[model samples]
Target: MLTRIVTGLALIVLSGLYWLQADAIPQSPMSGSVGADGLPKLLALVLCGLSLIFVVQSILVRQPLAAPGIPEDDQDEDDAAFTRRGHVLAGALLAISIVYSVILPYAGYTVAMGFLLLAVGVFYHRRMSAGIATFAILGAVVFHLIFITLLGVRMPEGIWPNVLAFLHAHTA
Candidate 1:
């Protein structure tokens, strides 16, 4: 019941923000038939619909909810544990992303992505050697192909750009 209520409230807030952003979206040459805001608006509408359904179901099922199987004291402990783990993972990911953004301008796509992937894998407790090797190789290859080769999108070229360029030239 509490979960449902909280989820519904979050959905409501997100939907409102999406709607407002959609409304404020300016016209652009790149605007396709649906435009920049279409997908977000559609997603927000779906979330709102789901939230309404959940609210209605919660209201209809008027059963007094017991504290989930755990004892009340244990439940608080479990919740805290869960929250701490979530925060740790979230913070790690956020830090990696921020570093990627900052370094991309200097390091170029391949190196920056390699570092980001390695950081994320290590942060998640993957075996260090395997994680670093796998993510570094995979991230560099995949993102280089997608953004640089296929999409023709420009990526940052910092100190590491020459290294990436050399690799690409030889490999290609």
Candidate 2:
């Protein structure tokens, strides 16, 4: 709840900054359509709305400040198990992310993104492994299409330079 409120307040502040910056954008005298500031204004408004929602939700939820779910009974074994499990999970995730960052250039965006997404999905929902893999791969593909193909962002090709070459050729 603290996290929610903090993030909401931060976003609200950022949205105000965005609004100020957007208003400073020069309007085109010739163009009759929406000016350069239109998109930024819309984005600022959306951010403000979402942040307000989060702040309201956090306030209404009233999350406890203390360490929640700590048993008062003789449950040392349970607590130890929980702590060990959390430590192991967090350590493993940290290690995986470090490796992901290191090998991202060598593996290329598609493979790296797919692996990252799949790892996260599997970590969260091990029972739906196949669905998670499919979703991750699909998401990676869509991200690649939007950033690499449409936006013309240059991602490292690594082992699959031909893929980017093909995309560039087709776009040309």
Candidate 3:
């Protein structure tokens, strides 16, 4: 319940800030159907609604916070251990994100994102294998297809100019 309240409150505050930032975006001279702020504003509104729902659900829930198989004393210890593990995992992911941001410009989106995905997969599962690399590369390609080809968004070309150029030419 406490977790729900904290998460919901944080989401609400963040969503409000995002909405304001989106609203601050200037209109384009040659505007199409949706303006620059359209998707961000809509996403913020959705986030706000979800946050309110979380808050309300937290308030309404009345179940006892006890594990069926564990004693109360052990349960507390388990919770503490779980919390510590969660904090460590969060820190690791944050570090990965910082590293990813620093290297993204140098490596380009496809390679950087593939590395990020593979790192995350390995971190969570505590294993690295050929499948991870295959999935990571596939994920990056799908992201490129959707974001670049379908959405017409520009991605960093970096070291793989010929690869991107070939893909763009064939797709176009």
Residue 36 alpha-carbon offset, candidate 1, angstroms? 11
> lDDT (0-100) at residue 118 of candidate 1?
82
Model 1 residue 4 CA deviation in Å: 1.0
Cα RMSD to native, each candidate?
8.7, 12.0, 10.7
Candidate 3 residues 54-116, lDDT tens each? Answer: 899788864544778644332355565467778888899999999888888778888888889
What digit string (tens of lDDT, one per residue) describes model 2 on residues 39-83?
999999999999999899889968444466754323366565457
- Show pairs that collide, candidate 2: none
Candidate order by decreasing TM-score: 1, 3, 2
Better of 1 and 2 by TM-score: 1
What does candidate 1's lDDT look like per residue over 24-131, in tens digits?
Answer: 989788898999888878888998888888777767766655668744322444465457778887787898899999998887778888888787778767668875
TM-score per prediction, in order, is: 0.47, 0.43, 0.47
What candidate 2 gets wrong by more than 4 Å, as runs, is 1-82, 162-172
For candidate 2, the TM-score is: 0.43
Displacement of residue 124 (Cα, Å) in model 1 is: 4.1
